[model samples]
Target: MEKTQILPRATEILPVMTAVMDAVDEESGKGQRDEATGPLFSENEPAAEYVTIGCSLKGGYRLTGVIAENTGESSIFIATNGQTERVAKVYHRYKKPKEEIIERIKSIRSPYVIPILEEGEIAGRFFEILPYYKNSDLLKATPLDAAFVAQVVVPQVNAALKAIHQAGIIHRDIKPNNLFFSDDRNSVIVGDFGISSILDDRQSVRLTTASRTLGYSAPETAQGFVSTESDYYSFGVSLLHLITGHDPFLGMTDQQILKVTLTDKLHIPSTVDNTIAQLIRGLTVKEREDRWGYDEVERWCEGQPVPVKENANRVKNIRPYVFNGEEIMELDKLALALAGKWDEAMKHFARGYISEHLLQIGQDLASTAADYEEETNREFGFFKLLYLLNPKAPLCWRGEFFTDLVRLGERVRECLPEINRDYADLLESGALLHFLRTKQLDPAVVDAFARLKERCRTDRNEAYYKMAFLLTGSNLMKWRGQLFDSVDALVGYLHANREGDIDAMAEELVGSKYFYAWLEHLGYGSILKQWRALPYGR
Candidate 1:
């Protein structure tokens, strides 16, 4: 743990503080009010970092620096005494007091609950201070495998929930963004109790507001319902994301998401262990009555058998690519809708090109999706749609990742004429820069990638650029070396780098947000061959 101490050079923050003071002085109470008074945070304006509040913190806590992350509702800042530090979550003025919530949290004594040290009001904004986690939460830095889930997340989360529910408190909001890890990366704590509600002795649904995060919500919860089981459903969604690196309802509208949640079962991939799958299945059950609660969750975490889910979305026939023109199924339509142009996408929509019908379905489905997932799905779909529209388009340049095993120079020499003719189909997917030495890039690959980028939007073109940067700007060559060339080398690197944590290394490799997309965009043959070369963590 890093010793919590104030920045020695207070001079560095003085200027920023001065600017904030000036800005605050100019405000007539509402510094930057919207056209109409927003429902939440009416008495308060957005917090500016470096602007000191009048309220003194309890327990001799003092500001470490001016660096703070502020949203509409609250500002998060680091504060510390000489020996200890904490994250102060200072909220704008609202009806409910922070003291009440603090007491509720304090009542729960669990390893999973992030401990609160102090609570006070600062210039009307209520601030609650808790132990500072060194690394960012699962939102930014998440590393989980089956063991991680079984040992850390599932057990801890359930323990916290058990303690809270026992005390008649329901954590209204639960998601990856709210879960955090300790500096050691061993303890995963659940925090952010901004919307938690205490249940009556009867233990009923307490919250009535429809302000919950989409995609992670239960079917009834999205319709302004909340209960003890609500958190369980949300945790199931979070669990799914932790395991699969994505939410099931990631790219749909709130309404569409609700429909899917109400009607469709979670599409747990066949690859997942039957026990783990059953746990997720029980938790995500559409009916709150059927859903797994703290007891079930705790049992599962303790390696006990739970009720196996009988129903799940079985993939009828898996496609190697998302853009197969063979038939327009649910999956194919999703990919098609992501296409940039209307006409091209509609050309393959349904029988007689009934785009309007498909368009409405797409809109509703997309509306329920998580914002980031929607964006990614849309972009990937567009890329796939483009490929469908023009089979010959060089969506991928000749060289991407480690696509080639044999002579790279000779293959490029052969593919030059086809590339010049804009026949990217002629450029073999297997001919990529596998043997990456320091800055030894083939000009043909560079030219081909540049040409592809010029034709596409900047955001769409970034994947290739990022890949290139990773290859050239970073020391991937020094790290990977001839590991992919031989099973022995791969094993040696794994043994040396991970200390027998091959599964951890595999999780790290696949955990990268860009890995799956890049692998998919790059042909399965070239990189898949190398990926298959590994001895373990396959």
Candidate 2:
């Protein structure tokens, strides 16, 4: 036979074929070649001549040519070995140290991690062989497929993480790319433990070096503190990414992401259900002490509660009776009278049937009085009437009333000394003074009013302002009848102050209607209506 010239490509292809032959030859090392067939075995012929004695390798070695392209500097081959004829991965020499590391991992007994089979120098360089995985990396799966991930994959991944932690190893790179499913989709196994750290038996699980994907590391990790809690934080972020199909800290730069994860509080989007949102938020807390532990997480997952935001709109529909306008108005009138609406004293007294709302109205009147300067006197009267009608009004309302009274008393203290004798007597009266001093006016407001009556005989301004303040109540009791004289006096003050500042005067006069009505009920309608023309359409 004439020798044929071989091109460079043909020459290059020959070495790969030779390497495959060499591997196959090593497997049949104990056997002799059959002379009849030369070195080339027939396609359908059984290799009985290549059988080794006593070592019956059941499901024996089947050396097939490299099934995949050599993407790296060397080629990879799939060889079947052992009982099941499981696929074996063969890596060429240039990728040696990593291959050796993979081989070292074979000593580990983790079901979740892929196991290495054999490693040694081949063709003057090192090579490693790992069991070829049947399924793709979890990264290749769509996160949106909830059925596959939540119901199946997630539990397995969680279990795998727990297993890894138990083995005293911290897989610093826990991410989708490192997880894989079995060919039958029956199991999940986490791989690529190259970056994992082995914790010292006595020491806790902690990472000294920062070796995590951005946006998934715990806030503490950014500060160079890594512990088991840090792993929980990363798991939380990973869960968020799976649910949202985007990084939780998306749009953030590496530095920004670290800054926020460490300092800023997290905000879960409204789109997520509350239970899950809260769980994730709890895990991502900036403080490690704040983060939930494994037991807490388990409890939450098992207890599974519906989110608060889901029921937010429904909660707004509930309203109590006190919120009704008609009921509120009735209560307001009563409160106003009790607080001392002297002008409408008789009117309120005749229609009186107090309700809880009435007391609330009294408090409202007091608040309104405190809010406006012009209405201060009128509000004081309303407060007095309320105290007189309902001696048992809440202490809170009474406290507020007394506070307002004290403030008003301070403002008028200098003026009181200059006022006429009648007013001075009213200010000095034992009942009013006692109530003012003791700060306990409940059940004493009536006597206080009587003292006002004796002083009004001479002091017009003091008695007038007092009467105006009391008669502002919308309802009144029998004793309020004495306020008619005071109501008349207050009306005079209103007329004097009315034309000076229309708005201020209007507010003062119209503000007194509650008391005016009470007085009208007591027989002063003519005067009450005359004051009503000031503002707010009476």
lDDT of each: 0.52, 0.45
lDDT (10s digit) by residue, model 1, range 442-476: 45545554444443343432334233322322211
Query: CA shift at 536, candidate 1, in angstroms?
Result: 86
User: lDDT tens string, model 2, 341-379?
Assistant: 233442333333233223344665434433332323433
Q: Compute the lDDT for candidate 1.
A: 0.52
Candidate 2 Cα lDDT to native: 0.45
On lDDT, the leading prediction is: 1
Best by TM-score: 1
